[model samples]
Target: MKYKIVNINDTGVRSVLIIYTGGTFGMIQDASGSLAPFNFGKVVDRVPELRQLDIKLTVISFPKPIDSSNIGIQDWKDMSYIIEENYAQYDAFVILHGTDTMAYSASMLSYMLEGLNKPIIFTGAQMPIGSIRSDARENLIAALEIASAHNNGNPIISEVCVYFNYLLLRGSRSQKLRSSTFAAFESENYPVLAEAGIEIEFNYAALKPHDENAQLNVINNLDANVTILKIFPGITEHSVKSILSDPQIKGVVLESFGSGNTMNFDWFIDCLIKAIEGGKIILNVSQCIGGEVEQGRYETSKKLNEIGVLSGGDITTEAAVTKMMFLLGSVEDVNEVKKKLTYSLAGEMDMMEE
Candidate 1:
């Protein structure tokens, strides 16, 4: 995929590549007064303050803008490819994406770009950039600043992150918790990596260590056959069976109740047992806001452990689902995949050894 550089200048300074994927931040109203995507070729025109920063800026926009809801595995691959191709050319990457699937994209990339040591910040706006009062300017400015931020001659934040509304959170650990509010994202089980106040205050203790030697290796083979099976009261056995019985499915993220508790019904346990025996990886993740999946924590969850369900400790559902896709495509052995599911590969989960 060929990408044109919009406003790149001398490499003597910190440079950030602004990846413009279609989102509200790039939308404007037409003569009919309906919101539509605006041409991002002049992105600096929309957010002129970008020119004031002590950094060189370049843009790579998608030929056809993609709304976040329509994002899929292919989009993830494309984004990775862009980063990999331009890894050495840019100091950082700031992806302008729709809020709907921003968390999912960020979570997926954390696993895909293993050993990445450069800042990759994803941000977008709740309202169009053309709106009388929009949050787009602040989000873009903060994200770009964080992307170019450095310390002691190395990048301060060297991992995948989502920067929105003044908070910087680990990509995989973040979740879009609200729909209508400015604070649309949250890292409930984990602390924010940094907060944008008078200046960007980075929590050095919370940053993930990087492998400088590994560079940017993008894993493109993501298995999309995984799904989340959230357990709710009176969820029919047939519904569970239909989900677990799919032969093509290699993994399932079971969104169990508080701390991985679920109905201890014999049929439910049997279905999970059958799936495990069939070589399907059943990942037990909590449905609660701030908790881990501790299989067998209570009587209801004990059967899950006995039946070979792997626990996902303090992992968000978004992380669990995307990580499952990454593992299912990468690992050939079911047992090895199960083991990796319980551990934190890219700081997706805060796993405590049992």
Candidate 2:
């Protein structure tokens, strides 16, 4: 069944700001035989479904919308700035972003907007919204609805999240799982915070509560001096040594094998040890799509645990990168940064059961 937005003209009408940051969702075929972003103000009128929602939506397009692939740390800062500048003016925010880097952007925003008390829903389409069979309309309409949904005069979700298909996932835990399917993202470690079926079902316990008294803080400074090292069966000592020896690098994410297992070679262990001693923060994250990083669970990973490599239990790569950046940017003390990496900030990690 096709999803349609239901209009509500009661006193509870919500006002939302839709930031169009260019993606397939806003593209249309131009006369020159190329796809370009049309004005969203005009684009919205074509979608009759939007009017049904009865919410006041304000479209704020970027000077030139960027593809999600080109999104970088600066883009994240800009998005945060926009929200911070207009925080009290809108009830919720809906970011129309591209799917390629949407998860990463969402995760970064989750950290940037710490202590958030309003809904920030990031969503985009697999197909262009102008297409006859586009997934854009449903995704956009539902995202706005979710953003506007409140309980007892307060917003339901107070954290950054991605709404795709029918599920609302914590941004830090979401990953794009499919290239072709409409159900493109999955939160492997965390359950759905909310689901949109015949009726929107919200797991209230799973939702991040709002603290109205806490002042909203926006963290824009992000350090990108981080590297990701993936371990392989026949990786050479030279490759591992070189990566660890980089003088400018501040952090490393070791994507080890199942259960965070790595090579038991002495040289490999020594390289990691030296890097850590040189003030480089190293975190061990599992290569598996849906498992925790147990550094000491196996003989191969025991050395990593002994040497004080941080454990990233079931956190996605997107979250690992942004979390490192956020921590590195905010804290000058390396030891304190290491401690926070292991802690569950913003529901990014699952607590290991004793």
Candidate 3:
């Protein structure tokens, strides 16, 4: 795919490459008053304040923009490939993506790009850039600032993150919780990496430190065959069987009730046991927004642990699904895949105690 590159600034000490992959942040009112992708080559025209920051800005845009809802495995490969190809040339990266699936994309990218030591910040808006009351300007400006930030010649933020509204969140830990508000994303299980007030304040302890010796590794292999099975109050056995019995599904993110509790009915337990016996890796995550999955803390969840279901402690559904996909596709050993699911990879989950 051909990329459109535009140099917005060339004199600053740090250079940041902006990867535009269609989103509301890049939309503008067209001749028909409909939202359309704007000419990002003239990004400085839309946000003139970008020229004032002490950072060199360059944009590489997708030839044909895509809605975030349509983002898939190939798009992930394309994004990671671009970052890999330009790794040596840019100091940091800013990805302008749609808010709908930004967390999923960011979570997957955190896994795909291993041994990363530079910032890859994702940012988007709930409203179009052309709108008079749009929050795009502040979000873009702050994201650029964070991406270019460094301490003693070292990148302050070495991991993938999402910058929206005023909070800088760890990518794998973030979840989009709102649709009609400016505060659309939250990292309930993790702390904000930074906050933008009158000035940008870095959360020094929460950041992943930059490692200069680590080389970038971009893994393009991702299996989309994984599925999420959410347990509801009145869910039927037929529904549970339909998902667990599917042979093509290699892994499942079981979104269980409070603290990973589920129906203790014999049929439900039997279904899980059969799925595990058939080589399906099941990870139990919580339906609650802010708690860890305590697999055996309650009687309802004891059967899940006894039947070989893995606990996804405090991991968001987006991260759990994508992490399962990443591990299943890249790791050949089934046992190794199951083992990795129990622990934190890329800070997506909190470490469970033995």
Predicted model with the maximum TM-score: 3
Candidate 2: the clashing residue pairs are none
lDDT tens string, model 1, 1-354?
Answer: 655457743333798989998988899999999988887878777777877888888889988889999999989999999999999988899999999999999999999998799999999999989887899999999998888888777888888999999999999999999989899999999999999999889888999864567666778888999988999999999999999999999899999999889999989999999988887888888889897777776999988888788888898889889999998899888777778888888888887533
Clashing pairs in 1: 292-314
Superior by TM-score: candidate 2 or candidate 3 = 3
Q: Clashes per prediction?
A: 1, 0, 0
Q: Candidate 2's error at 103, in angstroms?
A: 1.1
Worst 10 residues of 1 by lDDT: 3-12
lDDT of 3 by residue, 299-344 (tens): 9998888889999999999999999999999999999999988887
Tens digits of per-residue lDDT for model 2, 78-105 = 8898889889888899999999999999
**What Cα-based lDDT does every candidate model obtain?**
0.88, 0.87, 0.94
Give TM per candidate. Answer: 0.97, 0.94, 0.98
> Roughly what TM-score does model 3 have, to 2 decimal places?
0.98
Q: C-alpha displacement of 310 in model 3, angstroms?
A: 0.3
Selected candidate, larger TM-score, 1 vs 2: 1
Error of 1 at 184 (Å): 0.3
